[model samples]
Target: MPVTLRPLRVAAAQAESVAGDLDANVATAVHLVSAAADWGARVVVLPELFLTGYSPQAWLPELTTTPDDPRLEPLASAARERAVVVVAGAAVRRSGPDGSAQRFTLSLLVVDEAGEVTAPYDKQHLFDTERAFFAPGAQGASIVVDGWELGLGVCYDGCFPEHARAAAEDGARAYLCPSAYVAGSEHRRDLYYAARALDNGIYVVFAGLTGRCGGLDFSGGSAVYDPEGRALGRAGIISPAAVVADLDPVEVARVQAENPIARDRLGSLGGRSRVVVAGPRP
Candidate 1:
């Protein structure tokens, strides 16, 4: 039996942030979500730590958030009202009281059209500076939307091909990366994103944070690529705006059939296959 999934209209939100300003940041996310929905988007992706900006450790006292953080309600409310799926980022508080409070860079809110949170996926890989303040998430969690499994990663997670390949192995047909990557070093991130899609034969959806934060400027080259490693569309460097593209799972399957990168093929020699990890650029 041939399986099928609905093609999604997806948009990415790029924003200039005010670090540690939770209220204002949430408001800004709400505004972007509304704008994206207006453009007929069925799903929208926001940058990493969007609700409290990218730098939170320096403002720990001001940048606190619970799983049921009230700050995220507006995004859910807008999703429910607009009948769209919203994926917004935030620094999530992870603790059950007795345990110490650890912050995870979370792709916090995954709101369905019914205006309810269907599922939420946190970032598994914490970047260099992020390791100091954010705790890493375990593997295997993914967001299932309308029969398509969407794998979620933030920032540095995109640099790790294994993370994305694991998602594909777990039945993910698409991967969503919400990032706060800066210029110069962004090419490394971009290539890995492309490699993940090409290697796994899945779609890649990347949303990047723009403008400056903590004295560093973000690259903001948000983009989407097909399974064949072809870029469908890109938001361009340093530009902040929303763009939509159609994702077809059938095409992804076709590409996988043709490329067979992730498939194990039988050989005359038998029981041997080579795989390698491409490292970060200089």
Candidate 2:
């Protein structure tokens, strides 16, 4: 007889964030985290800029804050009490060097079961409109938990294959995307998300913001996909919801063994594709 490993239960949350309201947004995230935990999720993902709302055109500067801000304590407490990994989004302010202006980054903060907060993983690729208000992050990031390497990506970052590919090369078993995508872009999600999973043979979890926030209407298509690019669960386009799925390492192993794309690429592509070292994790 052999000891078996339990499948990892992950949850993707689709919720609305009120612009410029930190306390309210944190409360919402806490509630969602609790709900996900109650459903036995070991990892819970929220949408992009969920803490301050996805206000790219207005009120960005006012909503930006350092990763250590006390306002985020409630989320940390939730993660600690629930014993789950919470990945939430926010705009992080980083001071520039040598008297340069402060730079704001669209970032994801990872909270572990011990209530520890890791360094922020900023969005490497800024959307067209986002460039005006946010600076692009320098490096990608991933965290290892319960024998799984989970990669982090913001909304626009998922559009670029290299972003997710880099994480896959660095040993990520699953990719988590936090997005604030708008309506009328269903094709984008349908195409790219599946490709990302199929191309790398890694699980992909997407959490999108829903409802109208400010002047933008979000396309709430939160979903989780297996390594074979099969959707395990999905949420609606106009409602606040959550989708959860149990991802088995055995399934990932079976897919990778059958496909071997990542392994075969190493021989044919030479050095064109290389492992990207992610930023430090908690």
Candidate 3:
């Protein structure tokens, strides 16, 4: 590979969170951020709602936090020190219509290498049982990391082809999904992301949780798929692990050039209203 076109090293962290234990979860996330950074990952992705442990029964208005919350300072410190962007999930508090009240949305937090935290994607599709506890976001979001545009998605959001298609149409090279997939449903998790990647001819990453999370056993099948829908690395099931892969830009371009799906698609569709630039390209 030429120095001008270096591959991006990304990581998916699979870990167990203590239900409703925000402090412990934050600490664990900070540690994982460091681990990924030490392993030379320029971007680190964690499971959805890992900050709050993903328990609907324990849900409270107070569980929702803004990006400036002090509890997330440790994560910021780690990201800044390690110089790696951290993409994780949290229950974000948002103002309601006409300032009526605050609504909690399951959001994907883009913690940049500069320690800037932004909630660009709020998870438009709520999974089974999630509809009862969370509100769907308006649309999709994409972020630019080191010149490569990456689409953001939560667990259930990865199932929709339209969602990934829209992002790819809008110039996303990869989709980063933060999820908490339960046990026994491992097949769905396995199929959804791979299909999405191949369908769009883009990279797809699934970061999953492991062990017991909110009274459910989360299966850790975190993986990274190239444009050919091939797994780049092996991840453990029901074990805390970090799955890492080096994504080559040249390969993505080569595959997209050969694949005609993007050009064959009908009229352009709107996707990813928000565009976040992680930082300057190295």
Candidate 4:
């Protein structure tokens, strides 16, 4: 049998989020997922909050969906039929105290080729202004599809090293980020991704939303980075298109072995921990 994950075709769907239009958004997502599968992508990543767009605070209540809501079934169906893994975003509803529902800008799910939800990781870090309307999620997870273990992060979660580190430590060979990074935040799309890839010794795939949402201009620099901090390719700052790349696990391992920044440091941590705590604490 051929190596299913040795060279995986991955696509990043960089599309505009239709503000507060769940039906239209779902249609667009399904269309993109089909397009990705046609392009021979085994995995496809969508933008953060794509299902309901990056709606402002006022629209949060309208976009909430419980975990068992049927809205997610469509995406799962698409994944099963397409024989691809999808990581998409939504404004997910969570159980609050007293039976109230809490809303979050969550990366709602993971659907495999068998249409099963093998992993689900919500957005743990809410962006500025988002905290006013959304609650943070505590989910941390990774999914294995076709022998490739993938770590999923949504939007702001990409900025934190700990989130990426946790994912890397948990056996994620690739990190998939679905984002809605805005205009003034282009540096992270440019600089941070390379740094994270170098630091984690894994492939970093970022998919972002373009165009305006609630008056904020988005800069969609959807991209992929190799373990050596090389930019494979990227979408334009305002373009709505799909960016695809053939990922190789061998190349990922080769890059890390040659550089060995994160790997070396991680090895030393065990010994360093002994020295740091060698003395008694007061």
Superposition error at 208 for model 4 (Å): 0.7
Instruction: Estimate every model's Cα lDDT from 0 to 1.
Output: 0.76, 0.86, 0.87, 0.78
Candidate 2: give the clashing pairs. Answer: none
Please list the residue runs of candidate 2 whose C-alpha ends up more than 4 Å from where it truly belongs after superposition: 1-5, 57-59, 96-101, 266-282
Q: Evaluated with TM-score, which candidate comes out highest?
A: 3
Q: Encode model 2's per-residue lDDT on 121-201: one tens digit a residue.
A: 999888887888888899989987787888989988888888889999998989999998888987897678878999899
Name the regions of candidate 3 deviating beyond 4 angstroms: 1-5, 96-100, 266-282
lDDT (10s digit) by residue, model 4, range 107-171: 55667787775337778888877787677777778877677788888877878887887888888
Quick one: ranking by lDDT, best first? 3, 2, 4, 1
lDDT of 1 by residue, 171-279 (tens): 9988888888877777676687888899899998888888887677787877888887777877766445876788897888899898997786333556777777786
Model 2: weakest 10-residue lDDT segment is: 265-274
lDDT of 2: 0.86
Return the TM-score for candidate 3, rounded to 2 decimals: 0.90
Instruction: Identify the superior model by TM-score, candidate 3 or candidate 4.
Output: 3
Poorest 10 consecutive residues of model 4 by lDDT? Answer: 266-275
For all predictions, the C-alpha RMSD in Å is 5.6, 9.1, 11.1, 5.7
Q: Model 3, 1-282: lDDT tens per residue?
A: 644657899999878887777788889999888988889999999999988887786467787778988888999989999999999888888886887798888998889988999899899999877787789999889998888889999988889899988899999989999998888998888999999999989999889988887778888898999998998884767455788899888888888889868888868677758778697889
Q: What is the lDDT of residue 266 in candidate 1?
A: 34
Determine the backbone clash count of candidate 4.
Answer: 0
